[model samples]
Target: MGDSHTSHTGVRFELLGPLRALRDGVEIPLGPPKQRAVLAVLLLQEGRPMSYDGLVEAVWGGSPPVHVRNLVQKYVSGLRRALGDGPLLEWTGSGYRLSGAAVDDLRERRQLVDAALAARDAGELRRAAELVARAEELWRGEFAEGLAAPCLAAERLRWSEKRLSVLEARLAGQIEAGRPFESVHELVRLAAAHPLRERPVELLMLALCRAGRGTEALLAYEELRRRLAEALGTDPGPALRSLHARILRQDPALLAEPVPVG
Candidate 1:
């Protein structure tokens, strides 16, 4: 759950940003693009043996070359060499399995997020914020940025959504702990980045109102309303509209620390 690197003696695989491998502190040079893609497929299904047909489908999609099985074998050979003598990869007669204990940043991030949610449920606001903050730090960039395999698209989207959810939770926790001013800047940026996602915009408005900047909060809502009308042809949802109305009347409830939700 907590952030951790792979152990010194075990194989460490990184698939969150790019495909990387290390063993005992020495970097293993994964071969060319297709080879690395093969490694990704294997690592994504670590202990399970992926069939040759599955590997072919993952690496080449619908346009496999003639003698594609031979090509896949060659890639596997290169990966084995890159893996050195770690016995991490094994052939299971029908397919290959990547064995041994492996550390993955994506898995670790998921764990941290789970821990953060548990902390929040227990009313440990500060601990939840810290845990989600740690989880957010694991994302270096887009998932497997340079990997050109079609098979990674679904996983990439899934992980990206999880990351955004963690960000939203972290920001909400910060605002709920009587530190709306501390999160105002971040909420502003998040709202700008995702204009259609009303949660961040709502949070930004609440933080601004709580910070005694009611005018700016109103302006933020107006800008978002304009954008939404232009882009989606819809008014702000009920939650956001309610928040806007509350801010307009300087509702006393806004002065107290309230968890902003949309």
Candidate 2:
């Protein structure tokens, strides 16, 4: 592993959106989509060497053009020129590896999320919320947007799910800290965006109820129930239903601080 300052001086790869490279705070132009895809594979693998065959499969899936190895070499050479001096892209046996410390936005976001969870577990609610919000800010949009490579699908999905999980965890923490009103607008937008996801709707309902808008909370539940039934021929889950019942009975427990969702 390289020193933190050395890593900071090297090339930093961004794959959270379109593939981009930056060194000393200036953007480095990665050639075309295919070239970017190749770099993306290597970066996603960290410093692990990817064999020639593996690179081909990742870049082109099942059908690769003739003389694909030469084409891949071309891309690698282009990347080397674009990367300049700091980090080294080295050929290992029949494979290639990107060496030197590189910062990945996705990895950084995950680290922030992990830190937020640790803080929350340690009863540092305010610090946890701030960290999770910072993590959420790292996403510009979908991961590898405009890159149509099959090799990136799994990682993209994993990052997307983790982002949502972090967002929900943040909301839950806010609600538990008697800050439900603070997350109302965000919870509403999230519920509207993902009508079928019960968790956001549940959070929205809880937030509304906590804010003394119990009627609106019931309305949100009704809308979610109708949407779920119409779209998936199913009703809201038991937890939500029980919550609805609690709200209807004006359970004083609703006003009490609740446990954070894991």
Candidate 3:
């Protein structure tokens, strides 16, 4: 089903996984790479639209063929066919726009997660978790994996990193809400998966410490320190350092009762 809003103009693309496009609960295949690339650029610039020239640059770098503009129009026609009669494209004086929703999947998810985190910080933890959970569910893998487009690479990394940060926020909220020692194992796995991310390491330490595994918490810190030095030639940053200081001082905050689950 479509969202609370009306119509199929509000299509969402889940490029993080296998480039799944959905219009009103129906899967819309975006066709071959060049075609998908055109649609991807359009979706990424929803509402604002892109000129034919701009899209040519996005899809074909600087040296598009003489027929490139017509090719782009054809691809847009194909996208419209797949996406239904919604206003997927609106011809502007200079360009075309993807009308409504103003979302690529990652952008939509970012908005959702950010809103949730804001709510959670304002003492609406349950609402926050719900939003973040929905956002995280949208990620299947790296964004647009097979595309070698230079512009999209930076965008992919930016979106992926934002998703990771929001996920960490959700986990931190879970820890605060007394989800249980089960989080410890997950934190450990996260630390292993992303050895360079100090937040997960610190979270793992906190989880162990709160579970009365202070020795293991310190050990976790040592392991992270070693890994950081060996892998990145650097130490944990200020946040991790502060966490270490808290552990050493045996700050009572470490022992404080978990926040009540909302």
Candidate 4:
């Protein structure tokens, strides 16, 4: 079913970090890990019904408690009590739905990402970088960190990759907006953190070349090439190889201002 709340829910939720519910800026005690997992699924559902079977699958995976329905009812009661006023979590005859929740960090991050894309499309590169940076600040830690459900683990992995993608976009925007020097150190850290990941290395190479450190850029490419060959018995892909060649030829195009990063 659709949402019940016609207006703001007053309860601000966070699933990007640990699952948290805040009412009037005060944190509510959401009980145990399993209990928090229930909230995680509900928040992700966004006012849609979470059927008992769906809840069992999401919260307990393949080995749910024998008393699943009764356990769910108890969990819901605790959640309702913690939420107190305004926000409502109710059984909808068919399933459970939460209403009156507002401004979840997950949605907040999406909003910022959307704004950044709009700014980028408008050619407001600096504004795009700033908006993406704000979105990056939304994560206190990994999304729904350590809750045991397989579905949530999949969500965590997806969010992790998305965070990396956004970081790449933000760094790329900085380079294209005439701020390559500022992107180098962070790109360096990003490359080191995910050695097998190629985009950060690609951006790192571009940033170094743009900052007039062409020699270092070539070395960065060589390092990635060596790492890839040794680990996967393969070479850097075509785009990265082409970039390496461009840097080597001192492709004056590389020095040209506002070259979009690969």
Q: How high is each candidate's TM-score? A: 0.89, 0.92, 0.81, 0.92
**RMSD for each of the candidates:** 2.5, 2.8, 3.7, 3.8
Candidate 2 wrong stretches, greater than 4 Å: 1-9
Best by lDDT: 4
Model 2 misses residue 150 by how many Å?
0.6
Model 3 local distance difference test score: 0.73
Model 1 residue 258 CA deviation (Å) reads 3.5
**Residue by residue across 83-116, what tens digits does model 4's lDDT show?**
8887889989888898776536877779889999
* Candidate 4 accuracy as TM-score: 0.92
Q: Which ranking of candidates, highest TM-score first?
A: 4, 2, 1, 3
**What is candidate 1's lDDT per residue for 1-262, written digit by digit as tens?**
2233773436677776777787665668998988888888777885788888887888788889898988888988888887877646777898888776354786787788889889888999899899988887777687776887778766788877767777887888888888889989998888888888888888888888878899999999999999999999999999889989999998997778558421
Global CA lDDT computed for model 4: 0.83
- True lDDT of residue 65, candidate 2: 88
| TM-score of candidate 2 versus the correct structure, residues matched by position | 0.92
Candidate 1 ranges with C-alpha deviation above 4 Å? 1-4, 7-9, 101-103, 260-262
Candidate 4, residue 256: CA error in Å?
Answer: 1.8
RMSD of 4: 3.8
- C-alpha lDDT of residue 70 in model 1: 88
